[model samples]
Target: MSNSPAQDTLAQDFVAFAVESRVLRFGEFKTKAGRLSPYFFNAGLFDDGAKLGRLAEFYARRLVASGLQFDMLFGPAYKGITLAAAVSIELARLGQNKPFAYNRKEAKDHGEGGTLVGAPVQGRVLIIDDVISAGTSVRESIEMIKAAGATPCGVTIALDRQEKATVTTATGPQEAAESAVQQVQGQYGLPVVAIATLADLMGFLDVQSDAALVSARPAVQAYRQRYGV
Candidate 1:
């Protein structure tokens, strides 16, 4: 596919519609780190088939636009599994002819048993997911991908919070997570890419001109101040 108009449209929607729509509740949320966060972009809220389908289309568009050339798309178990199925279908719809696979949390004992389900993975693999918080899952995924005998080419996700610090340290969990991304890329030669960053979501909130958004502007700004790398 030669990156045509339709491709461009989908890429745009990936950032504006799919990614942005997911940023909900720009309010005080006690995060996993025990920090009071002003906003959250929970991909888990897309709890229906239609929303997931749209999300997949955008993900496929982003993968194409970002020039992530992969023979197989690997989604981690559970959430990744659903995302993988939807994205594979969207990619097919977009004429990408891509195959996708995901793993089980535990390997099945009977039938065609394996940790991984769906198509066989081969060549450079792209690991897809909703977000990257601490990157514990990402590292685990790398190991799993390697065990499956496919080289990880890249990692793609919907949103990048860009708040690379999550604790009181000079560098916190978010920093550590970003450091992990760089380290993975540097050590393993794999690139971790995202559709939109924290700034994009903040911008989207600002443009709405709503009071909730207006108030959130400051908290998000403070978040960037405190956590930004």
Candidate 2:
């Protein structure tokens, strides 16, 4: 889908906010896949009330603007729990009230006696998450939603790394030559909407005069050229 000027501006603004909030940092950092990345984005760092509030606002705005249809929100266990709730509140504040639900990593033996929590998982559910590195969380969320009889319709994340994903096939592991977001969209037939992507980050840095950002551009660009989708 083509991004409107407003969407482009939001992407730029989100990149700026992430840097200012220190959620997106420039430095040598190792990913779970052991790739040395020039930059790191830790959504967990948006821990405080204020930062989370703003983060939710960004998610809400992006989802609303994307025009993805959904009847409810579903957050996976752990980080997604907070993300789903916060984004739901923010969406309601923006005049869209939707039911939100999440699952527990381990099902309870008492009380609710199940994994599902919050509002019942229902209708076309949109999954809210920080990022989709390996697509593990997304898979789990999809399963949970399906088990609850809800359709997994869309996913909204803070950023899209836009790097190729490795998948294990009958022949063995091989690069998918597509980003995790792309794979999710293809495999599940669902749209993955991200607030920004590696390309957007590059664009954000392009117009910046900050010496640090300018200096880091080369490394980020090289990394993208080598691993980007």
User: What do the candidate models score in CA lDDT, each in turn?
Assistant: 0.72, 0.92
Summarize candidate 1's per-residue lDDT along 8-92 as a digit string, tens digits. Answer: 4454455456534554567788866666788877788778888887788678767877776789888997778888878889988
Candidate 2's residue-wise lDDT over 1-229, tens digit each?
5578999999999999999999999989998776899999999999999999999999999999999889999989899999999999999999999999998888899997898999988889999999998899999889888988989998999999999887778997677788889989999999999999899999999999999999999999999998898
Q: Supply the global lDDT for candidate 1.
A: 0.72
Measured by TM-score, the strongest candidate is 2
